[model samples]
Target: MKDFVSVIITAYNRQKYLGYALNSVLNQTLDKDKFEIVVITNFEFNKPNYKNIIDIYDNQEYLGEKIYKGLHESKGDIICLLDDDDMYREDKLERVTSFFKTFYPIYYHNNFVTIDDKGNEIKIIEEYLKIPPYASFNLPEFTLAIENNRKTDIRNLLKLNVNFNSSSICVRREILENNAQYLRKIKAVIDSFIFYSSLLLEGNILLDPARLTYYRIHTLQTSSGNTKNIKEYKDSFSNLFKKAVEDFYIITEMLNGKINENILEIVNEELLRYKLLYKIFSGNNILIKTKFNIHLLNYYLLSLLPTFLGNLYIKDQYNRTKKVRSFQVKSSNIF
Candidate 1:
């Protein structure tokens, strides 16, 4: 019998947390036969029982390629991703299967809690996501309604501040299989690529409010591990901004004329802001001739301010963003 869900847990040198992640799957409320675990790791770790697990060892260091391999080898109707350092709640699989059975969305994402390395909850995921509390869980039944104006809906959703962590996202197997080629092209921002690709493909998405995954925040985490200074921070943001622009164009090209022009303008404006900041910190004059919006102009004027004030302003803004990007939850709340 075919498996109902395939949980792909990709690990790279995170052997310490792999056991916890794998055990979370094995201890799920869902039947053992209903789901299979696929472990894609570079090194062997103490995994759970081998009965329902498929361990694929690839010496290749790229995480994107490892994930692609797992997706290719997976044999299930639904695809769920688990980061090696993150874990699902015991009922995550159960809730996901139930939701899929009832509504059958192409993509499903649930709220997740952020945890520190010591396994203490720092803050609720919804707090960081900033999604409107009133956004309904069940989307409209008409796929065309979502497809015809996805760009606008997506822009509005982003404005409300949405986030997509891989462990919190699940996709129908067919969607991943269909988009595998495009997905393979992405190296670092695979999660963002999958999220936007699903939207552009007109795939219905179900955003569950329940916190179902434990996202661990640590110094070694990929996004947090690299930035030791302002230069690194600026480079990171620049790369992200460039990737967003690239993805925007790719999705636009794929959608033809179906995309909203207003959404394009919104993205362009956001990109301009990021570009201006990048120029400000990097001391680059590339954007000097570009048309300036109020936000960009403000940043420019701040960059020209007295050295102490400008540095203070830049440091304050950068530190605020770094905290968010690094998943530093300032709250003492525990879930």
Candidate 2:
């Protein structure tokens, strides 16, 4: 029988935490034969002798490319991605497989807990999600209802009001296969590409309320680390805004007739708002050369305000959407 799930872990210079992540997978409640682990690392290290582990090394340092390679090498009906610094709860795989058998969602994910570098719990995933208390539905039902109600989940996704952690997501292999063309076009933000493309292609997403993964937040992690200067902060936000716009266009073109027109309009409005903010904070000279509009006027007016006030606004917005921990942890022995 073919493997039921493939867990793909992409690691780069995180050997200190990789072993714990691997051990978490090895300790899953599911039978060893039901799932396989594929690790793509950028390190040359001693390899473990686990029979179910497949290791691939890439020296090029492209995260998206490594993920693409992992998908290509995966040989299972379902695919689950994990980051080397994060870990799965022992029953995550077993529960996910069982949920699939029951609801048959094309895409699925569970809530996750946030931890500090030393493995202390910072906050539960629900603290950040915009979902209402006690609101729950099966994946297929939710998707159908959303369409019937003339609402697109894509809006919530773009606003970072929903969870799309690569580590907590499990998708059908066929979804990835069908979207391989667009996936290859991605050089960064691979997780957003997969999530948006799959949903646009009419895949239903199931969100399990159980916190089944531990997402670690530390100084060395890519997204949350290394922003010591104003230039770094501006550059990071600029790149993020650019990628969000790119993904929006890519999905729009790929799912032309399938997406709602109103949804497209809404996304465009949001993009315009982001563009104005990007112009103000990014300090990119090219943005000033573009056609001016009310958004640009608003940006100019905002620029005339006290610098501290503009900075406060930006800081507030960043805190609302960033994946970094909202609270500090003082102690824990969980690791």
* Full-model lDDT, candidate 1: 0.64
lDDT of each: 0.64, 0.64
lDDT of 1 at 333: 34
What TM-score against the true fold does each predicted structure earn? Answer: 0.73, 0.76
Clashes counted in candidate 1 amount to 0
Residues 73-117, candidate 1: write the lDDT tens digits: 878888889998898899999989888877667777777777876
lDDT of 2: 0.64
TM-score of structure candidate 1: 0.73
lDDT, candidate 2, 103-164, per-residue tens: 67777767777787778887533331111111122122232212222345555544332334
